[model samples]
Target: MRKFTEEVKPSRAVFVKWPLGHPFGEPFKVRQHNAVIRKAFEALKTIKKPGTIIDLPFRWRRDEDWEDKN
Candidate 1:
């Protein structure tokens, strides 16, 4: 994680809740998907400066979900 952070060096980062092969939270599940995105954005809103790493209150079903798209 540290290495990747160093590579990208982003000002802020966002993590979401979902599952492997279902980043958007199951197909057609707009409500759940939106909730995940909203949570991430909510965490972002609390950041008042750069270099913030919000852990997010939610967690994806699996790390593989990180690469999933809908």
Candidate 2:
């Protein structure tokens, strides 16, 4: 994680606690996923300086909504 962060060198980074294949949210829950993205962007926009790490205030539910169909 540190290596990737160093390589990118972004002004800020938002880390979501979702799984690998599901970076956004459950498959079909586009609205929910997009909402999360928008919130992250909002946090980034508020940063006046660089080198900020904003852990998003969101979490993916492990209920039936996010069940692995495979």
| Top candidate, metric TM-score | 2
Model 1 residue 5 CA deviation in Å:
5.0
Q: Model 1: per-residue lDDT, tens digit, 28-48?
A: 756657766765666667777
Error of 2 at 54 (Å): 0.8
lDDT of 2 by residue, 1-70 (tens): 4456657878877666776677677787766677667766776678767866666545677444323321
TM-score of 2: 0.63
Give the poorly placed runs of model 2, Cα more than 4 Å off: 1-3, 62-70
Count clashing residue pairs per candidate.
0, 0
Model 1 regions more than 4 Å off = 1-6, 17-22, 59-70
TM-score, candidate number 1: 0.50
How does residue 55 of candidate 2 score in lDDT? 62
